[model samples]
Target: MVKYNLEPSESILIQSTGVCEGSGLMTAFTDELILTNMNIIHVSKGLFGNTKSVRKYPLNQVKIINGEAQASMGKSTNGIPNLQIYFTNGQLSFKFQSSAKKEIVKYVNGISKVLIGRESNLVANQFAIPGAEIVAETLKDTIGVFKGTLGIKSKGKAADEPVKATKKCIGCMSPLTGTKGQSIRCSYCDTDQIL
Candidate 1:
Protein backbone atom coordinates (compact mmCIF):
# COMPACT_ATOMS: atom_id res chain seq x y z
CA MET A 1 0.00 0.00 0.00
CA VAL A 2 2.35 2.70 -1.24
CA LYS A 3 1.05 6.24 -1.34
CA TYR A 4 1.67 8.35 -4.42
CA ASN A 5 2.12 12.10 -4.53
CA LEU A 6 0.62 13.38 -7.75
CA GLU A 7 0.87 16.85 -9.18
CA PRO A 8 -2.05 19.10 -9.88
CA SER A 9 -4.34 17.81 -12.67
CA GLU A 10 -2.42 14.53 -12.77
CA SER A 11 -4.42 11.35 -12.28
CA ILE A 12 -3.47 7.70 -12.22
CA LEU A 13 -4.61 5.72 -15.24
CA ILE A 14 -3.36 2.25 -14.45
CA GLN A 15 -1.19 0.35 -11.99
CA SER A 16 0.40 -3.06 -12.18
CA THR A 17 3.16 -5.03 -10.52
CA GLY A 18 5.55 -7.11 -12.62
CA VAL A 19 9.10 -8.32 -13.00
CA CYS A 20 11.30 -5.56 -14.34
CA GLU A 21 14.32 -6.49 -16.39
CA GLY A 22 17.59 -5.22 -14.94
CA SER A 23 20.67 -3.93 -16.66
CA GLY A 24 23.85 -5.98 -17.11
CA LEU A 25 25.08 -7.50 -13.81
CA MET A 26 21.93 -6.35 -11.98
CA THR A 27 19.33 -8.95 -11.08
CA ALA A 28 15.66 -8.57 -11.94
CA PHE A 29 13.33 -7.05 -9.37
CA THR A 30 9.61 -6.80 -8.74
CA ASP A 31 8.49 -3.28 -9.59
CA GLU A 32 5.20 -1.47 -9.52
CA LEU A 33 4.36 0.52 -12.62
CA ILE A 34 2.01 3.41 -12.10
CA LEU A 35 0.78 5.14 -15.24
CA THR A 36 -0.59 8.61 -14.78
CA ASN A 37 -1.88 11.35 -17.02
CA MET A 38 1.51 13.04 -16.95
CA ASN A 39 4.09 10.33 -16.22
CA ILE A 40 4.83 6.70 -15.64
CA ILE A 41 6.35 5.96 -12.23
CA HIS A 42 8.31 2.81 -11.48
CA VAL A 43 8.50 1.92 -7.80
CA SER A 44 10.81 -0.77 -6.52
CA LYS A 45 10.05 -2.07 -3.02
CA GLY A 46 12.16 -3.89 -0.52
CA LEU A 47 11.34 -7.16 1.23
CA PHE A 48 9.62 -5.33 4.10
CA GLY A 49 7.25 -3.54 1.69
CA ASN A 50 9.32 -0.34 1.91
CA THR A 51 10.02 1.65 -1.20
CA LYS A 52 13.65 1.35 -2.28
CA SER A 53 13.63 3.41 -5.44
CA VAL A 54 11.32 5.46 -7.66
CA ARG A 55 11.79 6.56 -11.26
CA LYS A 56 9.52 8.86 -13.23
CA TYR A 57 9.29 9.04 -17.02
CA PRO A 58 7.33 11.85 -18.53
CA LEU A 59 4.68 10.73 -21.00
CA ASN A 60 5.84 13.13 -23.68
CA GLN A 61 9.39 11.82 -23.60
CA VAL A 62 8.59 8.14 -23.85
CA LYS A 63 7.30 5.73 -26.48
CA ILE A 64 5.57 2.51 -25.49
CA ILE A 65 6.35 -0.76 -27.25
CA ASN A 66 3.58 -3.21 -26.61
CA GLY A 67 3.77 -6.99 -26.78
CA GLU A 68 5.38 -8.92 -29.61
CA ALA A 69 2.44 -8.81 -31.95
CA GLN A 70 2.30 -5.03 -31.86
CA ALA A 71 5.99 -4.21 -31.70
CA SER A 72 7.92 -4.25 -34.92
CA MET A 73 10.40 -7.16 -35.01
CA GLY A 74 9.65 -7.94 -31.38
CA LYS A 75 9.72 -11.38 -29.84
CA SER A 76 8.75 -12.78 -26.45
CA THR A 77 11.34 -14.98 -24.76
CA ASN A 78 9.00 -17.08 -22.61
CA GLY A 79 5.60 -16.43 -24.19
CA ILE A 80 4.81 -13.87 -21.47
CA PRO A 81 3.91 -10.43 -22.76
CA ASN A 82 6.28 -7.53 -22.16
CA LEU A 83 5.64 -3.80 -22.11
CA GLN A 84 8.65 -1.64 -22.88
CA ILE A 85 8.87 2.10 -22.41
CA TYR A 86 11.65 3.67 -24.40
CA PHE A 87 12.83 7.17 -23.56
CA THR A 88 15.54 9.38 -24.91
CA ASN A 89 18.23 8.25 -22.48
CA GLY A 90 17.17 4.69 -21.63
CA GLN A 91 14.41 2.11 -21.70
CA LEU A 92 12.39 0.10 -19.21
CA SER A 93 11.01 -3.37 -19.79
CA PHE A 94 8.46 -5.16 -17.65
CA LYS A 95 7.13 -8.66 -18.12
CA PHE A 96 3.72 -9.53 -16.73
CA GLN A 97 1.91 -12.81 -16.23
CA SER A 98 -0.07 -14.32 -19.10
CA SER A 99 -3.33 -13.76 -17.26
CA ALA A 100 -2.73 -10.00 -17.31
CA LYS A 101 -2.77 -9.81 -21.08
CA LYS A 102 -6.09 -7.98 -21.29
CA GLU A 103 -5.07 -5.47 -18.65
CA ILE A 104 -1.77 -4.80 -20.37
CA VAL A 105 -3.49 -4.25 -23.68
CA LYS A 106 -5.98 -1.83 -22.16
CA TYR A 107 -3.22 0.09 -20.42
CA VAL A 108 -1.23 0.35 -23.63
CA ASN A 109 -4.29 1.57 -25.50
CA GLY A 110 -4.94 4.28 -22.94
CA ILE A 111 -1.35 5.45 -23.16
CA SER A 112 -1.51 5.51 -26.92
CA LYS A 113 -4.64 7.61 -26.82
CA VAL A 114 -3.03 10.08 -24.46
CA LEU A 115 0.06 10.33 -26.62
CA ILE A 116 -2.01 10.85 -29.76
CA GLY A 117 -4.15 13.46 -28.08
CA ARG A 118 -1.09 15.35 -26.95
CA GLU A 119 0.42 15.29 -30.40
CA SER A 120 -2.76 16.27 -32.29
CA ASN A 121 -4.34 18.58 -29.72
CA LEU A 122 -7.68 16.94 -30.41
CA VAL A 123 -9.85 14.14 -29.05
CA ALA A 124 -12.73 12.13 -30.52
CA ASN A 125 -16.05 14.06 -30.58
CA GLN A 126 -14.37 17.04 -28.89
CA PHE A 127 -15.64 19.62 -31.38
CA ALA A 128 -18.82 20.01 -33.43
CA ILE A 129 -19.28 21.03 -37.08
CA PRO A 130 -22.14 23.46 -36.51
CA GLY A 131 -21.31 25.29 -39.74
CA ALA A 132 -21.70 22.12 -41.83
CA GLU A 133 -25.45 21.92 -41.37
CA ILE A 134 -25.84 25.62 -42.01
CA VAL A 135 -23.76 25.44 -45.18
CA ALA A 136 -25.77 22.50 -46.48
CA GLU A 137 -29.06 24.27 -45.83
CA THR A 138 -27.88 27.43 -47.57
CA LEU A 139 -26.66 25.46 -50.59
CA LYS A 140 -30.00 23.69 -50.84
CA ASP A 141 -31.88 27.00 -50.76
CA THR A 142 -29.57 28.54 -53.38
CA ILE A 143 -29.98 25.56 -55.70
CA GLY A 144 -33.75 25.84 -55.41
CA VAL A 145 -33.67 29.54 -56.28
CA PHE A 146 -31.42 28.91 -59.29
CA LYS A 147 -33.66 26.12 -60.57
CA GLY A 148 -36.76 28.31 -60.37
CA THR A 149 -35.10 31.30 -62.06
CA LEU A 150 -33.60 29.23 -64.93
CA GLY A 151 -36.79 27.21 -65.59
CA ILE A 152 -34.91 24.01 -64.65
CA LYS A 153 -36.93 21.05 -63.41
CA SER A 154 -35.31 18.44 -61.23
CA LYS A 155 -37.34 15.62 -62.73
CA GLY A 156 -39.64 16.02 -65.74
CA LYS A 157 -39.88 15.73 -69.55
CA ALA A 158 -39.60 18.83 -71.70
CA ALA A 159 -42.99 20.18 -72.76
CA ASP A 160 -42.04 21.09 -76.39
CA GLU A 161 -39.46 18.40 -77.30
CA PRO A 162 -40.32 14.84 -78.32
CA VAL A 163 -39.47 12.10 -75.80
CA LYS A 164 -36.31 10.07 -76.57
CA ALA A 165 -36.62 6.62 -75.05
CA THR A 166 -33.05 5.80 -76.05
CA LYS A 167 -31.48 8.27 -73.57
CA LYS A 168 -29.83 6.49 -70.66
CA CYS A 169 -28.97 7.71 -67.14
CA ILE A 170 -25.34 8.75 -66.81
CA GLY A 171 -25.10 7.30 -63.31
CA CYS A 172 -26.61 3.83 -63.71
CA MET A 173 -26.78 3.50 -67.51
CA SER A 174 -30.45 2.61 -67.13
CA PRO A 175 -32.81 3.55 -69.97
CA LEU A 176 -34.56 6.87 -69.27
CA THR A 177 -37.83 8.15 -70.74
CA GLY A 178 -37.41 11.92 -71.16
CA THR A 179 -37.26 14.53 -73.96
CA LYS A 180 -33.99 16.06 -75.16
CA GLY A 181 -32.84 19.17 -73.21
CA GLN A 182 -34.92 18.03 -70.21
CA SER A 183 -33.28 17.69 -66.81
CA ILE A 184 -34.14 14.34 -65.31
CA ARG A 185 -33.29 12.65 -62.02
CA CYS A 186 -32.36 9.00 -62.37
CA SER A 187 -34.79 6.67 -60.58
CA TYR A 188 -32.06 4.15 -59.87
CA CYS A 189 -29.26 6.37 -58.53
CA ASP A 190 -31.12 9.68 -58.06
CA THR A 191 -28.55 11.49 -60.23
CA ASP A 192 -29.63 14.75 -61.88
CA GLN A 193 -28.95 14.80 -65.64
CA ILE A 194 -29.96 16.47 -68.91
CA LEU A 195 -31.14 13.90 -71.45
Candidate 2:
Protein backbone atom coordinates (compact mmCIF):
# COMPACT_ATOMS: atom_id res chain seq x y z
CA MET A 1 0.00 0.00 0.00
CA VAL A 2 1.40 3.39 -0.96
CA LYS A 3 0.38 5.60 1.93
CA TYR A 4 2.24 8.60 0.51
CA ASN A 5 1.65 11.23 3.17
CA LEU A 6 -1.52 9.74 4.64
CA GLU A 7 -2.13 9.82 8.36
CA PRO A 8 -2.06 6.65 10.43
CA SER A 9 -5.81 6.12 10.12
CA GLU A 10 -6.05 6.95 6.43
CA SER A 11 -6.76 4.05 4.09
CA ILE A 12 -6.98 3.72 0.33
CA LEU A 13 -10.54 4.13 -0.95
CA ILE A 14 -9.89 3.41 -4.62
CA GLN A 15 -7.00 2.34 -6.76
CA SER A 16 -6.58 1.97 -10.52
CA THR A 17 -3.91 0.16 -12.45
CA GLY A 18 -3.30 2.55 -15.31
CA VAL A 19 -0.95 4.79 -17.19
CA CYS A 20 -1.14 8.54 -16.70
CA GLU A 21 -1.04 11.06 -19.54
CA GLY A 22 1.75 13.58 -19.63
CA SER A 23 1.77 17.15 -21.00
CA GLY A 24 2.87 16.09 -24.48
CA LEU A 25 0.77 14.04 -26.88
CA MET A 26 3.39 11.30 -27.22
CA THR A 27 4.25 11.24 -23.51
CA ALA A 28 2.59 8.69 -21.19
CA PHE A 29 3.75 7.04 -17.99
CA THR A 30 2.66 4.10 -15.87
CA ASP A 31 1.55 4.93 -12.37
CA GLU A 32 -0.52 3.61 -9.52
CA LEU A 33 -3.43 5.95 -8.90
CA ILE A 34 -4.72 5.80 -5.34
CA LEU A 35 -7.46 7.76 -3.62
CA THR A 36 -7.45 7.92 0.15
CA ASN A 37 -9.32 9.90 2.81
CA MET A 38 -6.53 12.41 2.94
CA ASN A 39 -5.22 12.61 -0.64
CA ILE A 40 -4.96 11.46 -4.23
CA ILE A 41 -1.59 9.75 -4.60
CA HIS A 42 0.05 9.06 -7.97
CA VAL A 43 3.19 7.00 -7.79
CA SER A 44 5.45 6.16 -10.68
CA LYS A 45 7.84 3.30 -10.10
CA GLY A 46 10.91 2.90 -12.28
CA LEU A 47 11.79 -0.29 -14.18
CA PHE A 48 14.21 -1.31 -11.44
CA GLY A 49 13.85 -0.88 -7.69
CA ASN A 50 15.26 2.69 -7.93
CA THR A 51 13.84 6.03 -9.12
CA LYS A 52 10.29 6.65 -7.87
CA SER A 53 8.13 9.77 -8.16
CA VAL A 54 5.11 10.38 -5.96
CA ARG A 55 2.65 13.24 -6.35
CA LYS A 56 0.06 13.78 -3.66
CA TYR A 57 -3.03 16.02 -3.96
CA PRO A 58 -4.55 16.71 -0.57
CA LEU A 59 -8.30 16.14 -0.38
CA ASN A 60 -8.86 19.47 1.39
CA GLN A 61 -7.36 21.33 -1.55
CA VAL A 62 -9.09 19.53 -4.45
CA LYS A 63 -12.63 19.26 -5.80
CA ILE A 64 -13.89 16.93 -8.49
CA ILE A 65 -15.71 19.05 -11.08
CA ASN A 66 -16.32 16.40 -13.73
CA GLY A 67 -15.91 12.70 -14.47
CA GLU A 68 -16.80 10.71 -17.55
CA ALA A 69 -16.00 7.45 -19.29
CA GLN A 70 -14.81 7.48 -22.86
CA ALA A 71 -17.58 6.45 -25.23
CA SER A 72 -15.55 3.80 -26.97
CA MET A 73 -16.67 0.80 -28.98
CA GLY A 74 -13.31 -0.83 -28.42
CA LYS A 75 -13.35 -2.42 -24.97
CA SER A 76 -14.74 -1.75 -21.50
CA THR A 77 -11.35 -0.95 -20.05
CA ASN A 78 -9.50 -0.15 -23.25
CA GLY A 79 -10.35 3.51 -23.78
CA ILE A 80 -9.29 6.33 -21.49
CA PRO A 81 -11.39 7.47 -18.54
CA ASN A 82 -11.26 11.12 -17.48
CA LEU A 83 -11.70 13.03 -14.24
CA GLN A 84 -11.37 16.78 -13.96
CA ILE A 85 -10.41 18.16 -10.54
CA TYR A 86 -10.16 21.77 -9.44
CA PHE A 87 -7.63 22.40 -6.72
CA THR A 88 -8.35 25.44 -4.58
CA ASN A 89 -5.04 26.78 -5.82
CA GLY A 90 -5.26 25.35 -9.40
CA GLN A 91 -6.84 22.65 -11.59
CA LEU A 92 -5.95 19.59 -13.65
CA SER A 93 -7.31 16.64 -15.58
CA PHE A 94 -6.40 12.99 -15.00
CA LYS A 95 -6.70 10.41 -17.76
CA PHE A 96 -6.53 6.72 -16.92
CA GLN A 97 -6.06 4.10 -19.63
CA SER A 98 -7.33 1.19 -17.52
CA SER A 99 -10.36 2.72 -15.87
CA ALA A 100 -14.11 3.05 -16.51
CA LYS A 101 -16.42 6.05 -16.08
CA LYS A 102 -18.49 4.58 -13.25
CA GLU A 103 -15.33 3.68 -11.37
CA ILE A 104 -14.10 7.24 -11.84
CA VAL A 105 -17.41 8.63 -10.56
CA LYS A 106 -17.24 6.40 -7.46
CA TYR A 107 -13.73 7.62 -6.71
CA VAL A 108 -14.74 11.24 -7.30
CA ASN A 109 -17.63 10.86 -4.91
CA GLY A 110 -15.36 9.28 -2.32
CA ILE A 111 -13.12 12.31 -2.55
CA SER A 112 -16.12 14.60 -2.14
CA LYS A 113 -17.27 12.70 0.94
CA VAL A 114 -13.86 13.09 2.51
CA LEU A 115 -13.81 16.81 1.77
CA ILE A 116 -17.43 17.70 2.73
CA GLY A 117 -17.94 15.39 5.74
CA ARG A 118 -21.14 13.34 5.82
CA GLU A 119 -24.29 15.42 5.19
CA SER A 120 -27.80 14.52 4.12
CA ASN A 121 -28.35 14.94 0.41
CA LEU A 122 -32.05 15.69 0.71
CA VAL A 123 -33.25 19.03 2.11
CA ALA A 124 -35.84 19.37 4.86
CA ASN A 125 -36.90 21.99 7.38
CA GLN A 126 -38.89 21.65 10.60
CA PHE A 127 -39.56 24.32 13.19
CA ALA A 128 -39.74 23.77 16.92
CA ILE A 129 -43.22 24.05 18.46
CA PRO A 130 -43.78 26.77 21.06
CA GLY A 131 -44.16 25.73 24.68
CA ALA A 132 -44.55 26.75 28.32
CA GLU A 133 -41.80 25.62 30.72
CA ILE A 134 -41.58 25.04 34.45
CA VAL A 135 -38.06 24.93 35.88
CA ALA A 136 -37.77 22.91 39.11
CA GLU A 137 -36.11 23.90 42.37
CA THR A 138 -32.29 23.90 42.59
CA LEU A 139 -30.88 20.37 43.07
CA LYS A 140 -27.14 21.17 43.18
CA ASP A 141 -26.85 20.34 46.86
CA THR A 142 -28.56 16.99 46.38
CA ILE A 143 -26.39 16.13 43.38
CA GLY A 144 -23.21 17.08 45.30
CA VAL A 145 -24.22 14.99 48.31
CA PHE A 146 -25.14 12.06 46.11
CA LYS A 147 -21.79 12.12 44.31
CA GLY A 148 -19.77 12.51 47.51
CA THR A 149 -21.49 9.56 49.24
CA LEU A 150 -20.80 7.40 46.16
CA GLY A 151 -17.22 8.70 45.86
CA ILE A 152 -17.91 9.33 42.20
CA LYS A 153 -16.43 12.18 40.19
CA SER A 154 -18.51 12.08 37.08
CA LYS A 155 -16.86 13.28 33.88
CA GLY A 156 -17.78 16.82 32.70
CA LYS A 157 -19.79 17.51 35.88
CA ALA A 158 -17.61 19.39 38.34
CA ALA A 159 -17.12 18.37 41.96
CA ASP A 160 -19.18 21.39 42.99
CA GLU A 161 -22.48 21.36 41.15
CA PRO A 162 -23.56 24.53 39.37
CA VAL A 163 -26.94 26.13 39.94
CA LYS A 164 -29.67 25.00 37.56
CA ALA A 165 -30.77 27.66 35.08
CA THR A 166 -34.33 28.99 34.87
CA LYS A 167 -36.43 28.51 31.76
CA LYS A 168 -38.79 31.02 30.13
CA CYS A 169 -41.06 31.09 27.13
CA ILE A 170 -39.31 32.81 24.27
CA GLY A 171 -42.53 34.10 22.68
CA CYS A 172 -44.23 35.63 25.73
CA MET A 173 -41.21 36.01 28.09
CA SER A 174 -43.21 34.24 30.79
CA PRO A 175 -41.07 32.67 33.54
CA LEU A 176 -41.20 28.87 33.33
CA THR A 177 -40.34 26.41 36.08
CA GLY A 178 -39.26 23.02 34.77
CA THR A 179 -36.30 20.76 34.02
CA LYS A 180 -34.12 21.49 30.99
CA GLY A 181 -35.29 19.91 27.71
CA GLN A 182 -38.65 18.93 29.18
CA SER A 183 -41.64 19.52 26.88
CA ILE A 184 -44.47 21.34 28.58
CA ARG A 185 -47.51 23.21 27.37
CA CYS A 186 -48.07 26.79 28.44
CA SER A 187 -51.64 26.91 29.79
CA TYR A 188 -51.79 30.72 29.55
CA CYS A 189 -50.57 30.85 25.94
CA ASP A 190 -51.90 27.48 24.61
CA THR A 191 -48.42 26.80 23.14
CA ASP A 192 -46.71 23.44 23.56
CA GLN A 193 -43.14 22.24 23.49
CA ILE A 194 -43.29 18.79 21.98
CA LEU A 195 -40.95 15.91 22.53
Candidate 3:
Protein backbone atom coordinates (compact mmCIF):
# COMPACT_ATOMS: atom_id res chain seq x y z
CA MET A 1 0.00 0.00 0.00
CA VAL A 2 1.12 3.52 -0.74
CA LYS A 3 1.31 6.07 2.07
CA TYR A 4 0.95 9.82 1.57
CA ASN A 5 1.96 12.64 3.82
CA LEU A 6 -0.74 14.75 5.42
CA GLU A 7 -0.46 18.47 5.94
CA PRO A 8 -0.60 19.78 9.48
CA SER A 9 -3.99 21.41 8.90
CA GLU A 10 -5.54 18.18 7.61
CA SER A 11 -8.61 16.83 9.35
CA ILE A 12 -9.34 13.34 10.72
CA LEU A 13 -12.80 11.91 10.08
CA ILE A 14 -14.48 9.07 11.95
CA GLN A 15 -17.71 7.54 10.72
CA SER A 16 -18.96 4.74 12.90
CA THR A 17 -22.24 2.78 12.75
CA GLY A 18 -23.37 -0.14 14.88
CA VAL A 19 -26.54 -1.89 16.01
CA CYS A 20 -27.81 -1.49 19.56
CA GLU A 21 -29.65 -4.11 21.59
CA GLY A 22 -33.33 -5.13 21.20
CA SER A 23 -33.84 -2.44 18.53
CA GLY A 24 -33.82 -2.90 14.76
CA LEU A 25 -32.45 0.52 13.87
CA MET A 26 -28.82 1.05 12.90
CA THR A 27 -27.15 4.09 14.51
CA ALA A 28 -24.11 5.86 13.11
CA PHE A 29 -21.57 8.42 14.31
CA THR A 30 -19.85 10.73 11.86
CA ASP A 31 -17.21 13.04 13.29
CA GLU A 32 -14.51 15.26 11.84
CA LEU A 33 -11.64 16.87 13.71
CA ILE A 34 -9.01 19.41 12.65
CA LEU A 35 -5.69 19.55 14.41
CA THR A 36 -4.58 22.96 15.64
CA ASN A 37 -1.20 24.02 17.00
CA MET A 38 -1.60 23.48 20.71
CA ASN A 39 -5.29 23.47 21.47
CA ILE A 40 -6.87 20.73 23.57
CA ILE A 41 -10.29 19.16 23.07
CA HIS A 42 -11.77 17.30 25.97
CA VAL A 43 -14.59 14.74 25.57
CA SER A 44 -16.94 14.38 28.48
CA LYS A 45 -17.38 10.93 30.00
CA GLY A 46 -20.91 10.51 28.76
CA LEU A 47 -19.86 11.23 25.20
CA PHE A 48 -18.67 7.63 24.79
CA GLY A 49 -20.18 5.49 27.54
CA ASN A 50 -23.84 6.29 26.89
CA THR A 51 -25.51 6.64 23.52
CA LYS A 52 -28.15 9.22 24.36
CA SER A 53 -27.72 12.03 21.81
CA VAL A 54 -25.30 13.17 19.13
CA ARG A 55 -22.27 14.81 20.73
CA LYS A 56 -19.02 16.47 19.72
CA TYR A 57 -15.79 16.61 21.69
CA PRO A 58 -12.29 17.95 21.24
CA LEU A 59 -8.88 16.61 22.14
CA ASN A 60 -5.48 18.30 22.27
CA GLN A 61 -4.68 19.68 18.83
CA VAL A 62 -7.81 18.00 17.44
CA LYS A 63 -11.40 19.16 16.99
CA ILE A 64 -14.55 17.12 16.53
CA ILE A 65 -16.88 18.68 13.97
CA ASN A 66 -19.73 16.19 13.95
CA GLY A 67 -20.62 12.97 15.78
CA GLU A 68 -23.66 10.67 16.09
CA ALA A 69 -23.05 9.19 19.50
CA GLN A 70 -25.75 6.59 19.68
CA ALA A 71 -25.87 2.79 19.41
CA SER A 72 -28.72 0.97 17.68
CA MET A 73 -30.33 -2.02 19.30
CA GLY A 74 -31.88 -4.81 17.23
CA LYS A 75 -34.87 -6.92 18.00
CA SER A 76 -33.53 -9.93 16.05
CA THR A 77 -30.14 -11.67 15.86
CA ASN A 78 -29.35 -10.15 12.43
CA GLY A 79 -29.19 -6.64 13.91
CA ILE A 80 -25.44 -6.54 14.63
CA PRO A 81 -23.64 -3.49 13.30
CA ASN A 82 -20.08 -2.81 12.16
CA LEU A 83 -18.39 0.55 12.67
CA GLN A 84 -15.86 2.07 10.29
CA ILE A 85 -13.47 4.97 10.91
CA TYR A 86 -11.39 6.71 8.28
CA PHE A 87 -8.16 8.57 8.99
CA THR A 88 -7.16 11.05 6.29
CA ASN A 89 -3.56 11.53 7.38
CA GLY A 90 -1.89 8.49 5.77
CA GLN A 91 -3.07 6.23 8.58
CA LEU A 92 -5.98 3.82 9.05
CA SER A 93 -8.30 4.34 11.99
CA PHE A 94 -10.20 1.69 13.99
CA LYS A 95 -13.51 2.01 15.79
CA PHE A 96 -15.15 -0.26 18.34
CA GLN A 97 -18.62 -1.75 18.13
CA SER A 98 -19.72 -4.94 19.82
CA SER A 99 -22.72 -6.46 21.54
CA ALA A 100 -20.75 -6.65 24.74
CA LYS A 101 -20.42 -3.25 26.39
CA LYS A 102 -17.12 -4.05 28.08
CA GLU A 103 -15.55 -5.17 24.83
CA ILE A 104 -16.62 -1.96 23.16
CA VAL A 105 -14.95 0.18 25.81
CA LYS A 106 -11.71 -1.80 25.71
CA TYR A 107 -11.52 -1.65 21.91
CA VAL A 108 -12.10 2.10 21.93
CA ASN A 109 -9.44 2.71 24.57
CA GLY A 110 -6.89 0.44 22.87
CA ILE A 111 -7.32 2.14 19.50
CA SER A 112 -7.26 5.61 21.10
CA LYS A 113 -3.75 4.98 22.39
CA VAL A 114 -2.61 3.94 18.93
CA LEU A 115 -4.11 7.11 17.43
CA ILE A 116 -2.34 9.34 19.98
CA GLY A 117 1.03 7.55 19.50
CA ARG A 118 1.18 6.12 22.98
CA GLU A 119 2.67 2.89 24.31
CA SER A 120 0.20 0.06 23.94
CA ASN A 121 -0.65 -3.12 25.74
CA LEU A 122 -2.96 -3.97 22.86
CA VAL A 123 -2.60 -7.73 23.21
CA ALA A 124 -3.76 -7.85 26.79
CA ASN A 125 -6.37 -5.20 26.12
CA GLN A 126 -7.97 -6.98 23.13
CA PHE A 127 -8.22 -10.49 24.60
CA ALA A 128 -11.89 -10.06 25.33
CA ILE A 129 -12.89 -9.45 21.71
CA PRO A 130 -13.85 -12.53 19.64
CA GLY A 131 -10.99 -12.60 17.12
CA ALA A 132 -9.20 -9.36 17.92
CA GLU A 133 -6.86 -11.04 20.39
CA ILE A 134 -5.62 -13.53 17.80
CA VAL A 135 -5.17 -10.83 15.19
CA ALA A 136 -3.38 -8.55 17.60
CA GLU A 137 -1.19 -11.38 18.79
CA THR A 138 -0.31 -12.27 15.21
CA LEU A 139 0.56 -8.66 14.49
CA LYS A 140 2.65 -8.54 17.63
CA ASP A 141 4.62 -11.56 16.48
CA THR A 142 5.05 -10.55 12.85
CA ILE A 143 5.44 -6.74 12.89
CA GLY A 144 5.84 -5.89 16.58
CA VAL A 145 4.41 -2.62 17.91
CA PHE A 146 6.21 0.21 16.12
CA LYS A 147 7.07 -1.24 12.71
CA GLY A 148 4.50 -2.20 10.08
CA THR A 149 4.13 -5.61 8.50
CA LEU A 150 6.12 -6.60 5.42
CA GLY A 151 5.24 -9.21 2.86
CA ILE A 152 6.87 -12.61 2.70
CA LYS A 153 9.11 -11.77 -0.28
CA SER A 154 10.13 -8.36 1.03
CA LYS A 155 13.44 -8.86 2.83
CA GLY A 156 15.22 -5.50 3.00
CA LYS A 157 14.63 -1.87 2.08
CA ALA A 158 11.50 -1.33 -0.03
CA ALA A 159 12.34 2.12 -1.36
CA ASP A 160 11.43 2.78 -4.98
CA GLU A 161 14.06 3.24 -7.65
CA PRO A 162 14.57 6.75 -9.02
CA VAL A 163 13.57 7.46 -12.64
CA LYS A 164 15.96 9.11 -15.08
CA ALA A 165 15.56 10.75 -18.49
CA THR A 166 17.98 12.13 -21.07
CA LYS A 167 17.93 14.87 -23.69
CA LYS A 168 17.22 14.23 -27.38
CA CYS A 169 19.35 14.90 -30.45
CA ILE A 170 18.76 18.30 -32.10
CA GLY A 171 19.23 16.87 -35.56
CA CYS A 172 16.94 13.79 -35.67
CA MET A 173 15.11 14.55 -32.44
CA SER A 174 15.93 11.04 -31.26
CA PRO A 175 16.59 10.11 -27.64
CA LEU A 176 20.23 10.58 -26.56
CA THR A 177 22.25 8.77 -23.90
CA GLY A 178 25.33 9.75 -21.78
CA THR A 179 26.51 13.33 -21.07
CA LYS A 180 28.10 16.00 -23.30
CA GLY A 181 31.69 15.04 -22.43
CA GLN A 182 31.30 11.29 -21.86
CA SER A 183 29.65 10.26 -25.15
CA ILE A 184 27.27 11.99 -27.53
CA ARG A 185 25.43 8.92 -28.80
CA CYS A 186 21.68 8.49 -29.36
CA SER A 187 20.35 5.14 -28.27
CA TYR A 188 17.25 5.27 -30.49
CA CYS A 189 19.24 5.75 -33.75
CA ASP A 190 22.87 5.06 -34.75
CA THR A 191 24.02 8.67 -34.34
CA ASP A 192 27.31 9.59 -32.68
CA GLN A 193 28.73 13.05 -32.28
CA ILE A 194 31.62 13.20 -29.75
CA LEU A 195 32.11 9.70 -28.40
Which candidate has the top score in TM-score?
A: 1
* Backbone clashes (count) for model 3: 8
lDDT by residue for model 1 over 53-161, one digit each (tens)?
8878887776444311121111246544556556666666665544445545555555666676432111122234758778999998899889989998766454454
Q: What is the C-alpha local distance difference test score of candidate 3?
A: 0.36
Candidate 3 segments exceeding 4 Å error: 1-10, 19-54, 61-115, 126-195
**Which should have the higher lDDT, number 2 or number 3?**
2
Q: Model 1's lDDT to the true fold?
A: 0.63
> Between which residue pairs do clashes occur in model 3?
19-72, 20-72, 20-73, 21-73, 23-73, 23-74, 41-58, 41-59
Between candidates 2 and 3, name the one with more favorable TM-score.
2
Let me know the TM-score candidate 2 reaches against the reference structure: 0.45
Better of 1 and 3 by TM-score: 1
Q: In what order do the candidates fall by TM-score, top score first?
A: 1, 2, 3
Residue 114, candidate 2: how far off, in angstroms? 1.2
TM-score of 3: 0.21
lDDT of 2 by residue, 1-195 (tens): 344566798888888755453333543545667888787777876544232788887777763333321111112234444555667787555666554455556565666567655421211111112231222223655776798899988677552555444666665767766655567777668677632
Top-lDDT candidate index: 1
